[model samples]
Target chain A: MNNEKIRNLKTHAANIRKGIIEGTYAAGSGHPGGSLSCADIMAYLYFEAMNVDVANPKMLERDRFVMSKGHCAPALYAALAEKGFFPMEDLKTLRHIDSYLQGHPNMDTVPGCDMSTGSLGQGISAAVGMAMAGKLDNMQYRVYAVLGDGELEEGQVWEAAMSAAHYKLDNLLTFVDYNGLQIDGNITEVMNPEPIADKFKAFGWNVLAVNAHNFEEIDNAVTQAKQTNNKPTVIIAHSIKGKDVSFMENEASWHGSAPNKEQKEKAIAELDALLKELGV
Target chain B: MAEKIATRVAYGNALAEFGEDKNIVVLDADLSKSTKTDTFKKKYPERHFNMGIAEGNMMAVAAGMASCGKTVFASTFAMFAAGRAFEQIRNSICYPNLNVKIGATHAGITVGEDGASHQPIEDIALMRSIPNMVVISPSDAVSAFEAVKAAISHSGPVYIRLGRLDVPVIYNKESLDFKLGKGIQLTDGRDVTIIANGLMLPEAIKAQEILKEQGIEARLIDIHTIKPIDKDIIIKAAKETGAIVTAEEHNILGGLGSAVAEVVVQNSPVPIKMVGIEDKFGKSGKPAELMVRYGLTPENIVEKVMAVLAMKK
Candidate 1:
């Protein structure tokens, strides 16, 4: 929570955002809006919060992260590359036929991906499983999962939520990227998953809300989630559809579209200016 | 005749027997009693997880547990486990090639009064289509027990189909060699070959007796492992017999019959007949009555054998 740490994380977040735009632009397809929306959270977790080792990606004791909203793989891949899990140059090969970095996070092919997940709702269930595994094995590893606000509409998410509470998986921490906009427009108009925190509360989760773009609030919510006991915690991080990029920010159309050459240049220039402001 | 035991009961007993291993875990989706996983739950409460009525979540949970070095066995009725949670089984378990065994009971029309809604007549076909998925339909209680053991030892996703109706125990447990992808030849003859799995094996055996009386020496094979099927044995049988008849308590379109034909036609061409439900659903009735109505009896197997033999030049 120090100023220096906040500045470092902000720089990392901006770089991750640039990487998201670069990958999506290069691939000519991807969920960029949601990916950019979660860049800060992903940066905070991989760089400051998670206990993963860059050298040994599969270490048994390392904390696990599952991208429940797997369409936002550009954000996760950027964070993993930034954390030295793989090379930064590989981001350009995002969804190519020969590339290991698949359109969705595949654990078998990707180094830092804990589970292969493209389908919504299934990732949180797998995260609950990983948390249960840590508890059953008497290991200290914790599990973290990030879900999109629209992704909460899947019934399987609630099923997994009920199970995490039933099994008392206190070791699990779930984050909902509440960007408010989905592919079809506003989430409320598409399929109202409003009061997401209240729903998780009803399901016996320790619910916390934070400004998803703020490094301090993100850290504070994660600290509180760690302190919570006897129940799983859900940090409902309020985020914009696109966090830093100006033309794409808050636009529902950007939810799954890649930027054109000019748009990519503008987004990268904006991210570079933000990184410079952070004094990185 | 040996004592009859339901394959589900055998599955439960095998789970309990395997519970002594520290790494083995059992999960069920609120149907432990019907699926026979309650026995394992009773013995090892800590290792057992009752996933409530959510079959899809149970599969992914088993996949997660399997990923963390636990030999997980998830049980539910075949209809829910194979049909309801097909995508979960494919993506979470089979796609990852996790060490999870899906022991689904109440397979085929033998689920009886529950009718087509509960009976999973196409589970083998559904499971066989997935990559890295091993499908096994144990014929009798002894082989069902051994199938559980084999599934645990083999590393990858496996679906073990168990029946609700009691089947006459054919193999002696002491002498049973239940290896993965290995077929068990119960009787050897030259006139025709009968490939059967699950509840149809006993009927195939009975049909063999009838064929003997008619001066047709029939060969009988209990195809316990349906996927990664014993292709060598199937090709050998086709070459030696020149005719084949496949029987099962499932749809004729895609079960043991389709699987055997895929191998036989490609490798060793032979005239083949399939004795099963003729691409129709079952109605509420007694298991025996449903078997007769669906043309899944010894008589039907004999008729198919006769028809197949006639077509064999």
Candidate 2:
């Protein structure tokens, strides 16, 4: 990982961590373990990779991002707020009655949210639709989606993966957050998709395996995907269950459960220091 | 000769005609031939998308296109469009109030030999339950054409329930009487009101003639729109005519019958007799025979109207 991109990515990741802690703590409920795991990738996409205009969130040709694993909505809502799509204050209302920051992303309610998603295995299909539409419209923008390792157990995800490969959607980029744990325990123990890369290859996709938390590897993977002529790319970024917060990292208990006031304070302190080191 | 036309064919013609303006796009699940959207694919190749049997993805894709300022018409069998993709329709389309047209075919027992599995007897109930969904079931070829046009012209998510068979053409070739969410009264009578939709509209008309022979005055209402269901017309018919009989080629549970009952029972509390397929699965037969077996014939409407009249007396 290069020094500059790494610093920028780490800074964004720390904020995403801060965003998750604050949003979930305020909402009193959310999926934080998965959110923290994708903090780095989401940060990398929004800050370093995606070509989008924050000023015109509805720009027709702007790049699109779909959070296929929508249970981790806190990560996305925080990223979008940080991007100035809405007031950062709105994240405090997560899951509250009449809150635009919902438990799942609603395209109409939340600005810059490309589609409404919460139903597992359905969001990627919507992302595929977006990718297909961009191709049909002859738009130059790319479409990227993030999926959870366990959330991939749903059959529709494979159905969409097969279709994307068959159509040769080169502009589509998908990230599988290879966090071992789901809501219960280890994904391998529950429902193992061990040969996931092979599954993608069989479905005709270009596959890559990398450390998701490493910005240089993620950035390099993104660059490689862009070079491909006519195949949808899948980057299986190996990630921990709950990343960054020392005590919480790789822990399954933090999956959907929010931290207590004391635990929240300790995690926020660690994230704040991490941001300071990156000069954010 | 009343040339035959399936609702799917009428859908393709009307939508293709609307595509001329460049704002409409057709999204299909690879059943374009069965849904008669092949006619549209021929007209505007760029505007039509054959997504190859992915009905759930088709709904979300239509919603995406709708978000990008294009009005999308998604075609599939009624079972898949309404039953398979209900959540997508509810969240992406109806919840946001997007302008996406869901043109579903093969509804009711009129699907005939396809039997219960391919047929969607409960599509109306599924669609009508959504908050902002506009549900329309045109009675014949002419109304199907107009229903497609009206769906595109009007705003929001519209579910156009269609049949797989060639029904009797009831409208004059030049009649442009299609309006959004309004009841079109076909006949007026002081004794009873026969409210009908889809394949049952023709049967209701036949029942009107039969009631006349029996010296019983009957009003016939063509209730094409089931969601913003013509409340003023239904209330007036019930109050002035004394009783109402609802007839639909759908399950009596949550389709047109339930919709009309909700209105009549709340506003007027007039006696209502619902004529439709009861709580039972459908079987393979000729469309005519299946209609009788499902109790969707004109004779069934007459009987139900008489039962309602007896209750009123």
Candidate 3:
């Protein structure tokens, strides 16, 4: 992401935030906080970095992305719909019955999704497996996975982390949505995963700290990851919970609660202004 | 004739034969030597992966390989393939219904000297609980070889539970039909039906012959696929015979017996007896001795059949 692309991503980031609020508000149930936080990282990957065919989602050589932080599904769904994986009208179906835009991402129902993922801490392992498969097949494609800061408490996640480093899967890139909030409370107060970068570094991954909200920085990190031939990379992205919405920003209550009628008006107002300011 | 051949060896032989297709890839967890996949590993090292003892990763890696249209056979111990990475098998493989064959050696008490820790008594139960998972146990090396060949040709996730030690070669080397999700009935009898699978099938066959000597005609069916179990056959056996006996090299519960019983008691109620390891973990010993002690031999199947027959009367 250079200066010109970053400008486009800034607009995408704002539209994605608006999409999150409007879609969840329509369904009356969703997690907006983490979605808001992860929007920019996802935007950067989808728009500027990943070597994926937006037309043929099942392309053999296409890059793969797995959202391990599944609660932030609203953000991904918004981005996917905007990218034309499905109808933009489907955004109204988030968490609804018989909807392709499931509350959680399911690979069977969604076209662009590489794997069905909802159980936290497991998706990253799948991404590692995909990356390993890429190496085995000698495919040029890479794999990217996103994890929640709170979901790191799972033991299986670390088991996968250890194995990923052991295999020297350089084609793998993991992003942690360090939003500092969980469903119950702040992650530090619940089960802290602070000093997260050190834990991954100890496991032999090349850890890179990034401003997840900045498209340029994230794109640069991904470009750097491709050059390193023998080691896997983990980008610990620092971000605000509920990034763009004024009332929801840094609030744990927004974890799964959809905005009520009055709250929706306020949230939409904030995102609309942000989108306009970014000229989208 | 009690010629011995290990299930793991038969597995490697089966894969070696499957190598002629050029699509079958063998993946292992550093247990290629133990799982008998080293033969396949040597032939197609490009297709085989020694994921270095990482069971969960191997399973997930197998799933990825399958997603790309390759027929992958991941070999490891039964305890690890069906136990340690149960979810990986469920989510990554079975959920999407990938074509991955899990050749797990050291299943049941048959892998005796490995101790109770390594023996996978609960493996059949665990895999049977999963949807779209095929659980097969070959009674002998000949059938084990055939089962591996069948699994490679079959589409979807198949769990081939094998043993570490050499067992008897019961089936004829020339030919025996062993397709997925179907049972091979060995003999015809109206008096009782003996259903057995995996390491216990040979014992069931032996028991059927013994029953015949006593003028008792017992039906024997080798259940190679646990999921999509030959419900139609088991149902007919229950309705027509009224007495059924299930033998396995697994725990009495959640194995073939329980899976059969679940169908029998529901659609067609019958007196069914289960012959297997009854709730006790096995210890280090010779494989034959352990099989006999665990009551998984032909003698135990006969006893269980008699008990169920008594209930029918």
What lDDT tens digits, residue by residue, belong to model 1 across residues A80-114?
Answer: 99888898889999999999999998888899788
Per-candidate local distance difference test: 0.92, 0.86, 0.84
Better of 1 and 2 by lDDT: 1
Candidate 1 whole-model C-alpha lDDT, 0 to 1: 0.92
RMSD of 2: 1.6
TM-score per prediction, in order, is 0.98, 0.97, 0.94
DockQ of each: 0.73, 0.50, 0.48
Which candidate ranks first by DockQ, i.e. highest?
1
- Arrange candidates by lDDT, highest first: which order? 1, 2, 3
Q: Top model by lDDT, which number?
A: 1
The TM-score-based order of candidates, best leading, equals 1, 2, 3
After superposition, candidate 3 runs with Cα above 4 Å error: A1-3, B20-23
Question: Chain B of candidate 1 versus the native chain B: what TM-score?
Answer: 0.99
Clash tally for model 1: 0
Clashing pairs in 3: B137-B198
